[model samples]
Target chain A: MNTTGPDSPSRRELFRMIGSVAGGAAMYQAMSTLGFAAESTYRGPVDLSGAPRGASVLILGAGIAGMTAAYELRNAGYKVQVLEYNHRAGGRNWSLRGGDTYTELGGFTQQCEFDEGLYLNPGPWRIPYHHRGLLSYCKKLGVPLEAFVQVNYNAYLHSSKAFGGKPQRYREIKADYQGHVAELLAKATRQSALDAAVSREDREKLLESLRDWGALDADFRYGANLLASERRGYAKEPGGGLTARPLPSQPIGLTDVLDSGLWQGIPSGDRYDMQTALFQPVGGMGRIGEAFARELGPLIRYNAKVVDIRQDVHGVTATYEDLAAPGTKLQARADWCLCTIPLTVLAQIPMNVGAALHAAISAVPYSSAVKVGLQFKRRFWEEDEHIYGGISYTDLPITNIAYPNTGYHSAGKGVLLGAYIWGQNAMEFTAMPPALRVRKAVEYGSRIHPQYPAEFDNGIAVAWHRSPFTLGCYGMWSEAARAQHYDNLCQVDGRIALAGEHASFIGGWQEGAVTSALDAIGRLHQRAIARGKKA
Target chain B: MSIRHVTIRLALAVLGLSAAAAQADDASFMPIADLGQANGEQIYQHICQGCHMPGGEGASGAGFYPKLAGDPRLASWQYAAVTVLNGRNAMPPFGLPEDRISETRTVHLSDAQVAEVVNYIRSHFGNTYADTLTAADIAPLPHPR
Candidate 1:
């Protein structure tokens, strides 16, 4: 298929069609229920007359999984109480609204192609159309989908040459710019010590390509090709393709292929491209947390740090301290409890009957990620052809960035770009102070822009690792913990329910959180019915 | 001499005009596979991770690869015909094989079977994402990649 033709349907038009149809259906439903309000909110307490004997449910954490489970269980008429350690909910799915614009600090993008009439870009960018559940959720949410531009990925090996000034694409420079890195890597593979000692030719080639890569205005196809080539071991075999070698087995190159090919699955043209949809919702991603607060209402008590969850074969009792008012302590009795807190936090949480449960909770493993958002005074890439947006280099602290204010309002002037640091770098970034982190980001950005002092400014930062309740961004499996443990994490332990992204078999993401919550609710409902029969 | 000079100028003008027109005509139809375009390579690098993956085993944040091979979705030949057109929970809408859209234009597949790479992804990664989604039964995906 030729991509440069004019007759193709723009992604915006497709989304418009989807939006009009979906919006019409939703509007029709809203009209039919115009006069109706939901029924009374009293879902009956967990007393013997209401909740069946030996049945009580408590949910901790107000994140997506916890909220989903609580909402579903409540709908099923199960007596439920949700306990959240944080003041709000939505977990990592955070949105920040300042001025007239809303920016999501976490989990920004979702893909709608997987599910018809869906808006899936929850964390920054939209997913590829292949994402089924996220697309389905988009259809459920009634948000139209968009596309990110599909382009090749490129990078420079040298730090000084590629860093600071303006970002550039690969083609704008001489075609031979990236050839040097390939040559060096191939040579290094055969001669280990020689690889460490750069010859004049290697150094010259590196500098030349760095200058050209920096001067070019084309998308770096290196990352994109790496995504395709890696699967086929393109990098494993030398000289097959530029992406054919280095990190032969992993998609790390592909991951940098485009921090988010938010446009890879959608239509052509910027009209409906995802650059327009990326935003941080007002307040925090936690504003979505307000939804839980609405449903849970006054039952949610803040600063009520939970100390223990103990069941005496009769019912479940929870002990906590009301940190809000000193000397204020409270105890709640329920037929059941749902523990949504992280297993790390759960281990520290005092549970009397905990030998087995503690072991299971402690066994779950999690990976950490660091996100740093930089608010710049101006969009420098717009001013210089040499500086392409979304430029990547190996030496920088942050490898990915996106131009967020690319909408009608953004005259391509001053814009705030979001930067992501993952894996080891993320861990390191989390340890730094706000000023230091900003300084590092600027320094990294300057490498791409020699004139960084003129184009860049300062901004704020947040470290998810330092967050008390979250402990880490989400879960990642260690070599020791196989897929079976993840499968078992979804299991319901009698009346005690588990819900959280970590508790999910899918492991680390917002989708895991939702799926796990939905599963827990179904299991809890079944348990409630079974207890009723026994009674 | 005067006549010859005028004729030469006219000939040069004609050549320049034809060259400009040719450039304009060719502008709208850039081929899908450009030697150094970088966009296709970038798309292949980033979006293919979920289905075809870095190793092309058809696995990533999503499930396995067999589900992607010869998928019915790519039959439309649109840029969005691959993984995202059908959809995945972990995958997004735009980066699928069918979603290979250009900033200035669109790409439609020449044939339905071109999506066989999805099959290649499946064969390598084993099975995932679909339940009994046979190569023969894959319906054409919605959006072109």
Candidate 2:
């Protein structure tokens, strides 16, 4: 019952099942027929057929936004070049692994101590099933995708306030909440409490539906019985042969359940965006970036830190420094510009753009997020708790602990998202040293998984604000700021335009980056064609 | 600032570890037995160091923590002082809310410590600013609810 439905098959599982039986083309068609397909703003592959003759465009940052622009424009027969501060592609779409050293703005380098084949996606970790554009790119780039479990029945829902700080299985909370609601509603319906709203026949139907849906007994009570036990789980699971008999577990009272607030995490996976069939790259989220980089090949320039951006009626040019060498100025020029650098970092750079655009640039602020990746000696969550994959929600400062979705049931070391703090809690974590952050994460996570302190081998923590590349996590647009500047931020300013999560409605997501890039490039292409006609 | 530029900032992170090293030296002789009263890097290490880097580099991945190392934003000491003492957007107020401090234990900076850390960040971390914060400067600000 912790899951949204009875075995909501993942997109991958559904696709494979449909593909094997119905073929690839038939699977695509059956996907819709089966009513499991997600409808997105993306209408299949984008058509970029009419690029101007020999027009060139310069892109800033090799993040998903910039790379999406590059990947599409090059296919449309235009010359494209991308400038990135880091040596690799994918700005926020990054992953850290063994032997990888990260130097934050303040130059304290922490080399990732993760073991082989293990990695921590410090950036965009999960891809929603509805983010069609990103998913299409994953397919096109040959980046295999797998289901990212957002909820597991055995995973925990912990509240520090109630249950004496003990963690509760997600199934217990979800099943009990629905049971109480059903019992109350069924009782009300049977007693004519809904006489004004429903006909007697309809009330009888509603009562019957509630009993079945809530796993209620014939009398419509959700008590210690086999019917309720089927949903909430049994004390001793039914087995075959001699030990097949089952014992029903008592459901927690509604008052205790309400006060505990474990219900807060029960519906997390039920959200439209966080539903079943969620995905991640087969290896890590960073693989998508690396795949895009591979597709772009030599077109991307690494370690080019943009310091200034200038544009004239004819073309746009960016002045950058060779970050590898330090202080040496370099230049890259093109007829049009699509700057995907985060607003926080971009605001500090000088640019030749209109006042409106400048104001828009300075208007938005980026958010703060911190992630701690802790490597454990073994897959304890899977081995001991049977929580194969999914997240454990907690009221502790760590906020949430996410078990690895990949390498499930394997006899090997594993990495867990030990801490994912946001807002004020994130700031408190961000203020600490990396080692201390890791230590603190282990400390807090131990409450949910008592095996944490013993199993934790090494950990790496990334505080997004400390990154020199983007300077912040993602653009955060307040209602007041969006009202004044959201449109202005997206409008192509002269020959210069900006594209990134900051320039779109879906801020803080890669889908925003992908779609915003597509929109910006489409407009830029139109402008380029118009300029060609004039020329 | 958005939540991206959320937490403690290292005024001097990107430049080098010298700023953190210098602060470490200042706190080297302090009694480790009393972390609650420790000042300078000790306070920063125990409090702000989780989100901010040891050298004041705020953490980064998808979120942003403004670096304390010679950040151009630090030009306005009042802005810096207010951001830390009163807290900024997404950053919980570090002053007057004793419950908040009791909850986290890291942000429990005394009036004197708040002023001291601000002054330390401004003066160190590759910043050569002469103007520094004082307890008097912090004491005058109204405590946030």
RMSD of each: 25.5, 11.3
Model 1 misplaced stretches (Cα beyond 4 Å): A1-56, A97-287, A291-296, A352-356, A383-394, A405-418, A450-452, A455-457, A533-535, B1-145
Q: Model 2, A241-275: lDDT tens per residue?
A: 99999999999987777667666666577656677
Off by over 4 Å in 2: A1-40, A533-535, B1-145
* Model 2, C-alpha of A263: deviation from truth (Å): 0.6
Per-residue alpha-carbon lDDT of candidate 2 for residues B1-145, written as tens digits (9 for 90 to 100): 1221222224334446553233332222222224346566555654565445666666443234667887998888777777776555334346735444422221345677777877778777688888767788888776543
Clashes of each: 141, 52
CA displacement after TM-score superposition, residue B34 of candidate 1 (Å): 40
Weakest 10 consecutive residues of candidate 2 chain A by summed lDDT:
A26-35
lDDT of 1 by residue, A1-535 (tens): 1123342223343345434533422111001011112121113221222434435467776766676666656655556677665555555655433222221122122111111111112232333333334344344434444343222233222222222324434331212222222333334434544334445455445334433432211322233243333332333555556654554322233123222221121221132222233223222334445555676676566655677777766567777766667566688777667777766556566675434555556554333344545544454554543233332333234544444422323342343333454433444454444455556566565555544556554444444444455554555443233343544555666557677766654445455566566666666666666666422
Q: Which window of ten consecutive residues has the lowest lDDT sum in model 1 chain A? A: A27-36
A310: Cα error in model 2, Å: 0.4
In angstroms, the error of model 2 at A294 is: 0.8
What would the TM-scores of all predictions be?
Answer: 0.49, 0.80
